[model samples]
Target: MSATALPAGHALRRPVLDDLPEVYRLLVAHDVSVLGFPDLTEDDLRDEFTEPGFDPVTDGWLALDADGVAVGYAWACRKGTSADVDIDFYVHPDADPGLGGCLLTVVERRAGEIGRELGHGRIRAMVGCYRVALGEAALLAERGYTVVTTFHRMRVTLDGDLADLADLADLAGPPVPSGVTVRVCGTDEDLLRAAHGVKEVAFRGHFGTVPQSFDEWYGHFAKRSSTDWSQVWYAEFDDEPAAMLLATNAFVETDNAGYVQALGVHPRARGKGLAKLLLRISFAEMSRRGRTSAMLGVDTNNASGALSLYESVGMRPVLEIDVWRKAITLG
Candidate 1:
């Protein structure tokens, strides 16, 4: 029945640039979401606070213990074309409650600043990939932030109906449909560059319209992934690049769970079953490797009927979850 002291268990407060390393370490330590995004390097931590258009001095804060060790951090910025949270942040393990509370205060403070600057009434705090992490998600949910939408961490089995994907095994694309050529891709530098190019084109207008820089794209996804270039494929019509399906396996410590990471096909080359074709390859290949199932995430509202396609392939939704969010108010 005793009152707890401030800055005791997990408190929040403004953070200096020096705390970047601790934040990065915290992210690496407890993230358990479906594998996405690159792990930030130690050197990258230094510029995290002020990277390009993001400056932590005014937009960031950290949660620290009485000993001044960082447990959690949060930062916010103005919303733009991407419809981002502007408020992005996280906390480390065994974070102090007092310190965590202070960090949330900073999140609110920055949210207000963004609202004022943008002349808007509401602000959003975007958390990247809400996995099993509690300190941040629980904190936000407690402060009236509910999950807004959800991106599925879905999976499907490879044993049943290999026909949908098997047909493409011998797919002999038309002889150079003018200037395009389709072939299984290699993990070489050139293919990586091509993969980057196609991704830029395909995702440019997709959901979360945030355009990623080449470095961000490479480091966060392509380069950072344990991508199996042998399994990657590219479609070229008339010998000109058009689409790709990038697949990789992240052998988690569990029994027999494999992941079908990315199943992207460029916009210009839609309607051709290229995705189904590539998925078949990945499925058959995964089955060959002693793995029983493959998993991939798809936007439920995707215009591409991605959910349907996945279901058609024996990949059903085992669970449904939402990304709830409550707008931050400056008034």
Candidate 2:
């Protein structure tokens, strides 16, 4: 890939694996400036660079100052089972305003190329950022993007006292309803298929739903070097799996926290309290592993009453992430 000319004092070039430290530094600095703490971890950066369907050499770009320090970074990856692409970029607080729009323009064009390569007739460019990221929100709006949805980054402390520990231990017996049982996924092929099937059923009709084969879904997870399949659990009611909770250490690795990558309850099992059961079980397991907190992101308008459920379980909103989308038109 050839370098792209940027502002007079900066140059844009393809990002390589070795650029992760500098890229992550820029991302965290931007994140902390907006959210009061770092949101992107080194592992997150690494995964983005190596995820399937994306070639860093062509899809990633970094804006560097004359001194060679990265001041901005952008990349796009195809969303599973769709012609849409998700683009994420971060600019240092000190970077030129023009750099933000420049990076976005490049990624948007790449998204269109990705769409055509995937044999899609139309494509969408989607992005997300903390609500506090006013500069990005304004830039997106100026560039014709619209706010499509909002998500809450919910969190809860797992460090419980003696009484709490006793309560959790009491729940260890059987957290689910009378006929339901919960267990971690097995490594066997059949068990993996069963777990993925439960996930597919549970997430149907959810916002931004994109159906993916088990291989694709698991492949994405496998890219995250820290993924622990043992933390992924499924709930079976009367010998039939009905719910799934996929957990990971992706975001909170340095914070000693656990993250719920996905939590879903089948429509048929909605009123059986399986969702809450899975959450409590996850919290207990995280605590057992010495994690001090648990975190997850959820759409504020989820049809499953997940917002209220999380609030009831002591999870509170720690950050607001807004999603913006616009159609892509290739030249």
Candidate 3:
């Protein structure tokens, strides 16, 4: 595309590596409240592009301003699709709010090309904005996207001055109902594959359920992520996959934070206290890693009342966000 102008001193173009620090800054100043990844580092930025199995072309973008300034970028992947997929975007506050729509147009055009190349149907996108983030909220609202879902950014502070976990033993109410076991995983692919099976079941009726192959899961999950398997937790009962928690450390410039990107319990595992046990296990692991806090997100209307569960474990909702969506059936 050629150069174009917005209402004021604004324009939109592609981004480059120099935009890394700025992107990180924008995400930090805005994302922490409703999303995780509170901190980011140049290494993190570089890793995002170089992480073993990440396909940068399919997952990233560069946005520039009128003066050729790298303003912001919108990026996401095919989260899932049975004819529709969910994509995520990150826009800058100082950039033209109007750019959101233009970018969505860009996304549709680009994704269509991608889908055709790979052979697929319509592309579904999921975008969200915290009410506190007026720019983001306005951008999505103006883009012809409608609110479809909501989630909360939950956090648990590991304060040295705080009461001990032992004091919360009552909160630990029940064990894994006997014959159930939970443990950490190593670099074993088969075992990882097993854990993923549990994930498949756990995410069956999730907000966006796109058919994801195990190859896709392994390619993206283990390879693209900055995972420390030493930090991941998994649970099983009667030798069947029951629950799992996969966490990664934040590569941010500040704040020693650990993030549990995916946490779920198999439908059959519900009410067994596996989720909370795995959560406490995650909390203990984070403390061992010297992290002062840990965070995760839960859909506000989660069928399982997950937000309430997190709160019961001292992970309070620090922010709320609404997911806006436009079905791709328009074509």
What TM-score do all the candidates reach, one by one? 0.62, 0.92, 0.80
Let me know the TM-score candidate 3 reaches against the reference structure. Answer: 0.80
* Model with the higher TM-score, candidate 1 or 2: 2
Tens-digit per-residue lDDT, 92-211, candidate 1: 545544445555566666667666776766666555445444555676677777775667767765455545654423323212344545566674667767766777777666555566
Point out the higher-scoring one by lDDT: 1 or 3. 3
Q: Over 4 Å off in model 3, which ranges?
A: 1-39, 47-61, 80-82, 86-97, 114-122, 160-177, 251-253
For each candidate in the order shown, give its overall lDDT on alpha carbons.
Answer: 0.60, 0.83, 0.66
Q: Report backbone clashes per prediction.
A: 44, 0, 8
Which candidate gets the maximum lDDT versus the true structure? 2
Per-residue CA lDDT of model 3 for 17-109, tens digit only, reads 666677677666446644554545656666666544234466566666667655556665454434444455555656665665555666656
C-alpha displacement of 171 in model 3, angstroms?
12
> What lDDT is reached at residue 196 by model 2?
88
